[model samples]
Target chain A: MPVNSTHYLFLSLLLFSIGIMGALMRRNAIIILMCIELMLNATNLLLVAFSKIYADADAQLFVFFIMVVAAAEVAVGLAIIVMMYRKVHSVDINILNRLKH
Target chain B: MAIYDILFWVLSAIAVGCALGVILSRNPVNSVMFLIITFFAISGHYVLMNAQFLAIVNVIVYAGAIMVLFLFVIMLMNLNADVEPQKGQLVQLAGVISGGVFFLVILAAIKSAKPELMDKTSTNIGLISDLGKVLFTKYVLPFEISSVLFLSAMIGAVVIGKKEETKPLTHNGEEE
Candidate 1:
């Protein structure tokens, strides 16, 4: 069967839902961050698909910008995670309950 | 056309399966590896969709740069399967159910969208030169701003990752 927008949509949806499940269910902060990256990619694929459907280069540029931002975000986010690890010596989110104190 | 369709199916299966592997793997390093494979599979889909620049950028930026950063951080933390935390079955099930509910809701909403069959013929929009032209023209402002953003992110990461000598953040007064 020829692939249509629906197929892309379903596949992106499934990837996104899996991302959400992984993000919510996983306690590892690093894994959670990875799931967030997965979600970002799910949307990026959909954007590329729609970009193709309309024959616009704008959506592709959006994907480009997203990569830019994601790169910066990863730099900062991983640093934060490393700092958190240095302090607590563990990457578990459960121990982050110090916010309640 | 039929070949593109077949490539799509094969790439989609690889993408989905590897994405599952990303979450299901107990080791952070393995998850990073799976995520890289998932990215490569997505890049393959980009090729099928004729998004050549994006396909290359997705691979170079994501699979190459981002995943490496992830791997570096994983290594810096020295995290292994032994350090991985397992959430309770009830919590995992609840998360899955909630996420599934979200998926079904979106699926139901989009079921009304007319599926448009895309043209897979070669296109100029995805070419490097044409994209560069547009990038340096209309989108140049955002492009410059992203550079600034990157600078700030660099500085911020250094600031945050620096050793703290002021406010203490530990238990039992130990600084190790």
Candidate 2:
């Protein structure tokens, strides 16, 4: 059997699931952020696959925009994490619950 | 044909395996390294798909810039496996089960819908010149708007990362 869009779809889905598991199982904020990036990359792979299959430039452009947004998100998220670390001295998410106090 | 198949399998395997390593690793720095590998593998997939521009941009932006930023943050905090935190076994099991169920559902749905999606024509739509033309001509407004978004993100990152001025900084030496 040759590689096809379905194969790419399956692979992307599997990667996405792994990212979700990582995000859910990790207590460290940085690790969860990495998992989110993994999920984004999974979707990017799928988008590129579809773009190739359909010969559509639009989807590829969308992927470019997605990368832009992901970059910005990571920047702000890491800054927030740094601030949180400065205050609470740990990147653990459980401490965020006490943020209201 | 065989080579294409082999390349796809190899790239996909690297992507998935490194992604697994990213989450499984106890150290933030290790996770960053694994994610970088995963991004590189994804970039290879882009190349295999003939999205050459995307492949290069993915490598430059993702593996080079973003992952390096992640690495710097990790190292800045001096994070190691000793300080790594993990969820309880029960919570982790539940998460895995949920993600597994979601994957199985999507797989079943896509398996039934696969054939209708295989016949689209391929073209040189992934070329840089073509993408640049579309980006500047058709998508010019959004392109410019993305710049504005980037500016805001830069400001936001700086603002959030900046030290509070409420507590005044004391000079360690006599002011000239």
Predicted model with the maximum lDDT = 1
lDDT of 1 at B28: 88
Error of 1 at B121 (Å): 3.1
Q: State the DockQ of every prediction.
A: 0.85, 0.72
Per-residue accuracy of model 1 over B1-176 as CA lDDT, tens digit each: 68888888888899899999998888889999999999999999888778899999999999999899898888887885556769999999999999999999999999999999886666788788988999999999999999999999999999999997788757888754
Model 1 lDDT at residue A17: 96
lDDT (Cα, 0-100) at B31 in candidate 1: 93
Residue B114, candidate 2: alpha-carbon lDDT:
58
Error of 1 at A48 (Å): 0.7
For model 2, how does the per-residue alpha-carbon lDDT over A1-101 read when each residue is reduced to its tens digit?
87778888899999999999898888999889989999998999889888887777999999999999999999999999999998788999988886486
Candidate 1: the clashing residue pairs are none
The regions of model 2 sitting more than 4 angstroms off are A99-101, B116-122, B168-176
Q: How do the predictions measure up, each by TM-score?
A: 0.95, 0.93
Error of 1 at B16 (Å): 0.6
Count backbone clashes in candidate 1: 0
- Cα error, residue B104 of model 1, in Å, equals 0.3
